[model samples]
Target: MTRLGYQVPNFTYPGVGSDGLFEAVAAQAVEAEESGFDTVLVMDHFYQLPMLGAPDNAMIECYTLLAALSQRTSRVRLSALVTGNTYRHPSLLAKTVTALDVVSGGRAQLGIGAGWFELEHDSLGFEFGTFTERFEKLEEALRIVIPMLRGERPSLEGTWYSVHEAINSPAPVGRIPVMIGGGGEKKTLRMVAQYADESNIICAPDEIPRKLAALDEHCERLGRDRSEITVTYQTSAVIAPTKEQAQAELDAAVAAIPELAARAGGVILGSPDEVRPIYERILASGVDGVTVNLPANGHVPGRVALLGETLAPVVNRS
Candidate 1:
């Protein structure tokens, strides 16, 4: 499980042009690995998320970036924060992650969720189905994907996806951890209890308790121990040398992307000492770990290192 994961969700840096963008990203990954972070994740989206910036903002393909990061850093596990199930077939998705695992020397984790971002789906010609339909597709995809990852040949005849004794050759270097992301109590948590090695709860700190309880109920109902699966919380942060500096950075971020302010209440913003207590409070809520994104200044050269230093002790203490 990733006790402290650093997510690189923003690709547009202030002065680093497109030519130097990848080097900038790789630097952050290296810094994260050198620091205390155990894993590095990227968002699986085609366009810049609406809340982050305009659609045209720099957004690279997820797996390609992860595969590249594998060569730059030797320790940190590589994965998309959560792959959208609607983008590719189950068999292909499994094969892709398996290849990544092989190349990364067995440090690969699969994080998946029901596809969202209706704009991307429509624009890219993927099926933009209703919420229920998307979940149905995700469940079917998992049924096929899980077996394939375990080196089993699974054949399924389902509405959304079907495979005939699909083979996953050159199996993963090791057991690829499966992480299901979302906080839906009924369907998502139920699936997580049934098939995932980890459950990433995408919510604020105040909601962690309820999400954990819901996951527990599902695990109990399925005759599974809640402890069998690791639980990780996902949120954003803004860190600097002092509280005022962090606030100023956050204010500038909100000014550039107005939509960010709407979710500002949930973002953790402060210096190392100021935010440690907040992370401690979240850990006290029963989450096994946390994966935070520094949306405001993560692309800056030493920011991820600072974040890793600040949060590693708090997370390791738990």
Candidate 2:
């Protein structure tokens, strides 16, 4: 069956931008669990925007939030939508995730991607390499991380990172799924075919079919089944009771995110009945899961509840 998931924003800069930070997240996690959402995902970004209050707002750290969140919600799975490779050493990352898995009782999944957003790197003074260099770093980091988690002591020297005898203790007692982020067909998908347990593609629903074909090609090249990697997405949305309410919500969301709105047109602005077909179309693209972007603040908790309780029920899977 196609799995359904939800993503809390990477930036806390929702409208009326208070550093509500993750204080609201704990509540949403509970709501998601009760509503039957399968996975509760959070985006990884270190900086706060103007609307989010300040450049360095009252944001909570991801690992800390995850720890607290694990305690708050019993059933739902938790993960970063994707962690940045540049933020921590691969060894440290693997170690941290191992701990999270242990505490969460095997409920942790690690999603990582090449780091972008030059502002965070520059402001924090972490090395902000070129895009190509970041991708290279991610490859080596994944290599170092996965093996260490499996109790293999791997030694590696790469352009960006090197580890020798980096021991990850109390190895992930479960599969500890690793999801590579991005739909960069040439580079990212190739990495997923060889490395990741999952990969994410962000596009309009119509664009997913072509990307899936490319992923299939990558799978063939790796002599692996495309089914081996779970395909997921970050799609726009709006859930309201009536056509007028949906339109009003969409209008508010667009005003809040003029750029994102212009880039994507309207979000999934409709009632559950109106929106179910959009999800069905997504499944037709061979997607096994989806992580709907909680693009707005006021609406997100309610929308997440609706998705778990309503939309997920009608999605047909074979």
Candidate 3:
């Protein structure tokens, strides 16, 4: 269930240009693995989202980057932070992630969600459906993806999709865990109860207990045990050797993205001594683990290492 995962959502590094983009990403992936991160995720987007930067900012295709990452690292699980279900065909995505599992020695996880970035869809000429339509597509997509992942050829005809005994060959070496990412109370959690192996909730720390309780309700209504699903949280974080430096990093982040000021409480800050208690509280709240983006200083070689060596043990223990 991803004990301590690291996500590399920002591709725009300080010194690395386009030519060295992958090298920079690989460097971080390797460092994350060395730092005790069990899973490493890259966002699935054709262009950088507004939260990160402009549309023209460096962004790589998700499956391609993951395939490349599979070659660069041996142990860490590779996947998209959450694949946009609208961008590619469900059958094709099944094959892609299966290939990733094959090449990465079965250390691949499929993290997917209802596609949400309108800009990418409009610019890339993909259908930008309404929210309800996207969720419908996601539910349909899971019907196809789950069976294919289990080495089945499903012939399905639904309101949103159609497949005729579509096959996935050279299937995953072992069962590839499917993670449905979102915090939608009604639809998303219900889908997780019915289908997903894991669920990633993205919300403020204060909101986690409520989210978990809602998920539990969804599971009970579906006659499923909540324990069947591994629950993880996704958020940005700031960690340093000292509290002052961590605060400075947090301040810089908030200054860069003014909206972050309000969400600062959710961002893990300060030294390991300080951060561990925050993590402990999160764990106590029933969160199985966390996936963090260290965009502020991930490019700095040793920052990830310090996070791993200092904070990982605490999370692991929890």
Candidate 4:
């Protein structure tokens, strides 16, 4: 199945307390599941970025949101966009997710990647180190996280982390998919091939074919079937009624995110009809899924509902 999922970055809002944020997001999450979205992701960030809002804006902790989302949505898989390796020990993360999985009735997956947001690290008083070092810690964290989740005895004495007798009380019944997020070639893909059940990439529609080829090569090196590791890419989609309107919305969003505008990769800016061809193009790229990051203006729920109500049929047909 060419599954379609929605990613909610939980950008921000003009809210003061958790009541408004929780009610709003939970409503959307339930709507997403009923709308037929395969999964729902909440961003893992300590603080809202400058682009989104001030540092102390309406933001919920990742795990707390996941716990609430677990109770609220029945079918939609819930996860962090990618949790920081530095935030918690692998064993603690394992136990947390085990309880989440149990509470959510096995509707949880772990989306983990090397942490990159410097402001989040600095603001939270987390040690912000060099990229290489962070990636190194990510590699070590994966070693610990995977084993603990699999009910294996985990003992790792790496440069960044050391854990002995790492364990979980209740192991997840099914292998909870470990999703690695990044578009890097050398280190990220190699590690995904070695350990991950899924891999996420960010690139233009034109670049996907090549990154996929690299991932396939990495799979071959690891002697794993490319099909076994689900292939999914992250894309920003601006949906409008007409081509002209969609382009206008795209311009508005690009103006909002100049850095993203400068990058030509994975922006699906068009009406549903125009974007239909793009989804077909990605479907032909040998991926199992496509995660559509919709516009988070007031109509996010409506937009996602429209996708599930409208575009999802097309996605399934492909």
Q: Judging by lDDT against the true structure, name the best candidate.
A: 1
Tell me the whole-model lDDT of each prediction, alpha carbons only: 0.90, 0.75, 0.86, 0.74
Give the range where candidate 4 is weakest over 10 consecutive residues by summed lDDT: 257-266
State the lDDT at 184 in candidate 4. 86
Poorly placed runs, candidate 2 (over 4 Å): 10-21, 48-58, 250-266, 297-301, 316-318
lDDT of 4 by residue, 1-318 (tens): 116777775445434255577777776677677777888887788786554445765567888889888888888888877787778777788887777788889888898888887888877788879999988988988888888888897898888888988867788856688888887888888888888988888776678888788888999988988877877878767676676766665566556554335432445766677877778778787777788766433234466665666557666676
lDDT of 3 at 63: 88
Q: What is the number of backbone collisions in each predicted candidate, taken in the order shown?
A: 0, 0, 0, 2
241, model 4: CA deviation in Å?
4.1
Q: All candidates' TM-scores?
A: 0.97, 0.88, 0.94, 0.88
Over 4 Å off, model 3? 247-266
Summed over model 4, clashes come to 2
How close is each model in CA RMSD to the real structure? 1.2, 3.0, 2.0, 3.0
How far out, in Å, is residue 107 in model 3? 0.9
Q: Model 1, 291: alpha-carbon shift in Å? A: 0.5
Error of 1 at 227 (Å): 1.2
> Once superposed on the true structure, which residue ranges of model 4 sit more than 4 Å away at CA?
14-17, 241-267, 298-301
TM-score pick, better of 2 and 3: 3
Q: Candidate 2 local accuracy as lDDT?
A: 0.75
